[model samples]
Target: MAQGNIGGLAGGMGRFTELRQRLLFVLGALIVYRIGCYVPVPGVNPDAMIAMMQAQGGGIVDMFNMFSGGALHRFSIFALNVMPYISASIVIQLGVHIFPALKALQKEGESGRRKITQYSRLGAVLLAVVQGGSIATALQNQVAPGGMPVVYAPGLGFVITAIVALTAGTIFLMWVGEQVTERGIGNGVSLIIFSGIVAGLPGAVLHTFELFRDGSISAISMILIALVVAAFTLLVVFVERGQRRITVNYARRQGGRNAYMNQTSFLPLKLNMAGVIPPIFASSILAFPATLSMWSGQAAGATWLQRVANALAPGEPLHMIVFAAMIIGFAFFYTALVFNSQETAENLKKSGALIPGIRPGRATADYVDGVLTRLTAAGSLYLVAVCLLPEIMRTQLGTSFYFGGTSLLIVVVVVMDFIAQVQAHLMSHQYESLLKKANLKGSSRGGLSRG
Candidate 1:
């Protein structure tokens, strides 16, 4: 019996080993990404950029830097992060709906998808070049609060080198993401972002502790902030997993010799279907001007531009309102793009499934639309609350915690997804074992019958 138990444990351990291998592959890819973050773009003065970033604290710039895992502050090769790729994807998605040719390609399935992806890649490269050039130009003009240069050499050579390095870094990241998806577990791009956020946690925690030691924040405030973070994390888990189940009844049809009756199923619509994309998009869009303004030194002619930029700075009241609005709007917009009520209704109708008390076509579509609208509202509110809570804490409590709602949400969601994937692999392994046992038992019974 002891031997049998040992064998069972070994079998279970083997399954875990398989899962561990997959996770190791993912971890390896993430290590590569972190290494890339440290590789500076050729010709950049790392010391100068770091000093400038340290001086310009709290604003859209800070937010973007956080997303890039401090690489932006270093002016590293991966300073651009994956923003350009995301922007390209958004543009392509929009084009697929508006442009007839792209729409036709979208309808063509896998091959069309490949073509669209190619186009998106090209678009990403173009955006990276533009954004990189913009950043390089901004660096030349931007001055630290103490009148220090952010860039050592402010010439065409530096600009060109920075742009090329940044663009190449983004493309390399795109490749890394693809490799992770193909060879490892978890969505590659999401995992990259997840890793970045997780990496920053240590520094953010250290900063919080420093603030406490310096008496900048009260002990009670630290407790309050912890409580807020825990509450927000729990809230995000709830809303992210929250779903509305729409019941559907399918009337079965008769086959050659048998008659079939009705069956029931449910359609699950997640409350936060758009996930964290909206906040990222909204932040990136707003950060553009602020980033440029910081780069441009807020010169005499651009004084008005600087004022507007400051007003729209992250953590400010007006900026928060606009950011919130943009988040809500994008949540709705992206939700519509991914979930088409009309298409869902038509597909269900074609499959002979209909929601009880609703017609198969237009009425069902309307019902779905109504439900989605309500769900989106709830989701948007949850997002706003999670996002704004941290900002409020920063303002009211004088806490130095750098983790924001967007980062927390992404980290939590990605972790949940990673866990689910691992669990699924384990479940499959268990099922296989059970099947093998059943087959062995059947074979033994057959042999006994022969004896």
Candidate 2:
């Protein structure tokens, strides 16, 4: 019996070799990513950058640093992070609706997808150049609290070099993402962001504990915070997995002489269809102006530009409100990009599937739209609550915990995605084992019958 049990375990293990190999490839790729994060861009003063980052504290730079796994603070090669690719993807997705040629290509299936991917890459390069130039300019005028320059060499050459370096870094990250998609598990780009967010967890936890130890944060408060975090995480899990199922009936057609009745199926629409993108996009947009302000030495002025800069400053009530609004706006905007009611309705109609009561085309589309709008409203509220709660806690408690709602959202979503991938692998392995066992039982039954 022991031998049999061992054999069964071995068989299960054997079935998981493919998944293990894929996971190994993913781990290796992530290691490569972490290493790249440390490679400094040319013409940057690492010391000066660190000082500048330290001075900023819990500002927009912290968000950038968190996403880049501290690469931005170090002025590393991966300083630009994956924002350029994200921006490119956003543009290309938007273009599909606006440009007829792009729309035509989008409908071409696999070949069209490849063409779009290429276009996205080109767009990434362009965005990287623009973002890199802006960042480089910011770095030029940025000085530490002690008045030391952030850039080692503050010249046109430094600007050009930094741009090229950051642009190349972003391009390399794009390639890494593609490789992970092809050869590893999980979405490569998402995984990169996941790695960055996870990297900061240790520091955040340590700081929280340190505050508690020093009596800066009471034990009771820490417990309360933990409970809140737990509740928020649970909320995210439920909402992320929440889906509305739309019932569809597919009428069977006559084949030869016999006619068959219809069959029923359901279309599942996720509550949070927009995923973690809204927060990221909102942060990117908000951070750009703050980064610019930090880079420029002149802070005190009665001018409109200074006023605009001050209003947009991180930790400000106005900035938080604007950021939340942008997050909500982007959530709706991105949801629209991913889900088109008209297109889905058309596909369902072409496939001979219709909602039980709704008409095949426009009515079906309208129904989907209505459902999505309600779902998006719920999603927007959830996002705002999750994101704002942490910020409010940080402000009220005055703790050094730097984990924002956006960071927590990314962490939770990525972790869920990673776990889902692993479960899929395990489920596939189990199915294979069950199939083999069924086949073996059938063979044994045949042998007994022959005997």
Candidate 3:
């Protein structure tokens, strides 16, 4: 047993080559992104930007910067992060429902999807340019509360250069995200955000301990907080993995002779049909204004701008309400966008399949739609509860740690997806190994008979 264990790695040397390659690709891509986070844009004063961010501690873009893995704070080439691409995706998704041409394109299968993706990339570029320009213009005029100037040279020249650099950086990050998704483990964008959230966990731990050491947070309170975080983590995993499995029955069909084989399967619809996307979209959309206001504050704001910022800041009542509403809305909206009951019904009908009690055509579609609607409503409510309630409590508590609701959701879901991918790869590897062993055994048997 010991000898076999020692040789285990050698025996399975090629078993997970693909998985190893994918993991290496993801790790290398993220390392590149982290490196770029520190490589400041040429024209901007890196120190000034850092000082400004430090001075504004926990501002709107602070949360955004945290998610961007500090890209924004550094004013790096990748400062815009994946926001432009996400925004473009959201725009294209919304447009599909509103524009006939887009809707038609969406229904065109793989080729159509490629066209939509191309258009989305174009839209991302446009958004990146506009957003990059905004940041550039804002930085040019920005003065830190401590009187540190963010831009050394404020003019059209700086603005133009910054815009081009930032846009190119964002496009590069977007490409990296796509590559990660294609060649690596999890959803690329989500994984990027997950890495950022996970990266801060050690800091969170240290801060928590600091609070305890300084007698700021009582041991009981700290314990309670830990318990709560664990509870929420479990809840998220449960809800995210929960599914509504509808039994599907397929009618037997005529074969080569008179043989007919009936089939039974289940059509699974997840409890959270939108997955982690609704919250992500909601957070991204809400955070945009906060970012704008955070920058605009540096320009000596209007009362209105401050008011908007105050209203939308995390932990505020208005922010919570709007955030919750957007989450619920996006939950339904995204769920609808991704799932087509009519198409599902048609496909099932063509395959001679039906729900146990539902009739085959439009009836089945209606039944599925009804089920989905109820599921989405429950899911939206669950999302609001899990993602918002913690923020509200944390606001009331005034704690410093930020491993909050959305971050938790992103982390948990991404980890789950990553694990599933690993399992899938391992399963495939095992199958290959078994096939090779079987082939070897067959050849050995023929040789033994000859001997």
Query: TM-scores, in order shown?
Result: 0.92, 0.89, 0.89
Clashes of 2: 0
Q: Which ten residues in a row are the worst by lDDT in model 3?
A: 1-10
lDDT of 3 by residue, 319-384 (tens): 889999999999998889889999899999999899998999999999999999999999999999
- Candidate 2 — which residues are off by over 4 angstroms? 1-11, 57-59, 254-259, 299-302, 433-451
User: Candidate 1 lDDT (Cα, whole model)?
Assistant: 0.84
1-451 per-residue lDDT for model 1 (tens digits): 4744565677799888887888899989899889988998877677777887887654566776777888888989999888788789888987887788999998999999999999999999999999899888777776665666667778999999999899999999889888887778888888987887788888779888988898888899888888888887788888888999999999887675578789999999999988888887887788777766665663678787688888987668898899899999999998988888998999999999999999999999999999999999989888888887787777765776577888888888988998888788889998887676677678878999999
Q: Please report, in order, the local distance difference test score of every candidate based on alpha carbons.
A: 0.84, 0.83, 0.83
Kindly indicate the candidate among 2 and 3 with the higher lDDT.
2
Return the top candidate by TM-score. Answer: 1
Q: Write the per-residue lDDT of candidate 2 for residues 361-417, one digit (tens) a residue.
A: 999999999999999989988888888787777776665546678888888888888
Per-prediction CA RMSD (Å): 2.6, 3.0, 3.3
What's each prediction's clash count?
A: 0, 0, 0
* Candidate 3 or 1, higher lDDT: 1
